[model samples]
Target: MRALLLTAVAVAVALPVIPAQTWSTTACGPAAVSVGDYRQYEGTGSGTTPFSFTVTVTTAPGCTATGSVAYATEHISTGPADITATSGTLTWTDSTDAKLVVVGVVRDGTPEPEEAFSLRLHTPQNLVITRDRGRGQIIDDDLPPVETGLDGGKICWRYESSAVEVGVHTNTPARAPITVHYRTVHTGSNPPGYYPVKDGIITIPTGSTRGTATIRLKTEPNLPDEQFYVEIFSPSAGTLGLSRVPITVKSKR
Candidate 1:
């Protein structure tokens, strides 16, 4: 009988072939659904430094997306809210793959100017947020770099003087407008008309931290006991402290 029909077709090909039962959906049409968009984090002032934002979620293949994603902070007073977010609630099982939601920003070293905030995405059940909202920027880095000094070291001229007032101090407060440069040093008795001796420019005005450089001495009339020096060179924004300032000319009484 043809060997009993070839042993019954090899026992029906060794039987056993079953795999079709992966039903567990929460229903999410439109090719499964997706949500991703959060790119804007520029903060490193080191007040605790930490500015990160990445929110992404895409599910479909057997779906199991549970939700509760809510983030807040929009147009805050340009500062204060610190920032923090690692999970606002978003669980997924049998996921289609692609899930990451992290947002953290908390660096308050104090010193602001460029600031903006916005990252919103709320209440999503079966999952569907093709790009909620994202826009964050905190670039102020705590503006600290503006130091110049010479409030008083010495200044006494009265031998044909016309002006004398040297006081330039700035540690912070001049967001704009600055200029500093002065020269004149005869050491001691170089009498021939000394005062301002050429080279000057001290104009710091924007919020004013103090700036005054008015020197002009040359009375011409047998001068002695002279001692000159008013130095503070090249400074358009800071760093020049104690810049040498001493002027005493009293010999014409």
Candidate 2:
């Protein structure tokens, strides 16, 4: 009889494997979008005609989107028409990124503070909007020797017209914002009561030639024609030129 030694066999126990934490689902994908901020010079008249700035859009590593995303811009200090296009789209893929090119006009004017605008992301198309609101800053380039003056030299306001746009101009664009002190002067030819006493400051922005002020006129259908002069005095920056401007108020028809 073979010596059947009762050898105790040690059996290995298999442990159950645990899976990873599922952060994403089929419906709620892992794709996300990011928008980048940018800053550039406002450009000059002699430099480039149409200056441009860029904003970058990046897709997440796990992005699986195939189409594009749309975006819109809001003018903070600049006007709607000042920037080339208000709304645009960025095309992207699972592995690619997109960029937005903002083109602007290089207006020659005084050097002033930096101007800014805003950009927003829209229409994610099922993707996540991780980051939005791209801030854009436009730096002024015009330097010193910027001469300031009055614009709309002579203007006529009809009785039907409630207000008129008057402005102060500069010979050259400055590097900083300018405050022009102006007052309505009532002379022998022009009397009071036709219009209210107007005295204020008009701020001319950087890289801009003119800053405007709206003057409200009194409607006098039966009164005679009236005239008054707008004179711009001490300016915050740069010397004043062509300070006086005449405004004539015509009687009602």
Candidate 3:
């Protein structure tokens, strides 16, 4: 009887010390939609509290349905809690080239699942990019500047109003992803040699008409100077495209 009494007292003492548990669903996890596409999503909530969610695609130039997000709220005042609840599936297509998706989730007045999902696609990475020089294919093989002296190369980038809009790529996390830029030596094997730079990403000013610039890649004498990889990112113009160039660096001396 004494043992039973001790057990009952312990249960009573511990009841008040428990904390509320948080819950979430994978509705916003890396959502993928083609350019001009849309997605419809839904999920069940817990207890009497209302459930809600918000969407963000760090790789923007993307939008919700109706130039905004479409949503409907449902209330479950009395139902057995079921883990079988499913979040909505978004419906989307290629628009403004391509887009990346990131989503957040909340439940029962608590924002538990933050940054719980992400999605990647093969749509417009850049608006306008070069496929090859007049008579030569673009190329670059060196590598990032971490080991090499250079980052990228003196390859040129081109874009037009039709190719890209001022705010088209504002949502992309990095200045430009791999697909938006292409890497080709200023002049292919035109007397190849050791070329080096500080980093891989190159900077060019946006021109009202068109623009050209030189980008360098990191290099090291100990590394092979004969061939290197040039990163290429093509504009979505209508969809995202990423590519790479190969350069056969000839010895300068």
Model 1: how far is 232 from its true place, Å? 15
- Model 3 segments more than 4 A misplaced: 1-213, 217-224, 234-237, 240-242
**lDDT-based ranking:** 2, 1, 3
What is the C-alpha lDDT profile of model 3 across 1-253, one tens digit per residue? 4555434443434446667887653332233223122221112132221122333322233432222222222223212231123333333333323222322222222222211221212222222111111110111111110011223232212211111111112122221111123344344353333343223342222221122223343343433234545443333111221234444443323
lDDT of each: 0.60, 0.64, 0.26
TM-score of each: 0.24, 0.41, 0.20
The TM-score measured for candidate 2 stands at: 0.41
TM-score of 3: 0.20
Q: In candidate 1, which residue pairs get closer than 3 Å at backbone N, Cα or C atoms, i.e. clash?
A: 147-239
**Stretches of candidate 2 exceeding 4 Å from the true structure:** 1-143, 188-193
Task: Report the error of model 1 at residue 233, Å.
Answer: 21
Best by lDDT: 2
Q: Put down candidate 1 lDDT per residue, 1-253, tens digits, no spaces.
A: 3554434344445768889989776666532334434432233334333334456665555544455455554554344556653336555554454555455666544565666566666666656777766666554434664667778755465664566777888887665556677877776445445544568888778677888877776675566656677888766543566888777767575
> What are the RMSDs of all candidates, in order?
20.3, 18.7, 23.8
18: Cα error in model 1, Å? 99
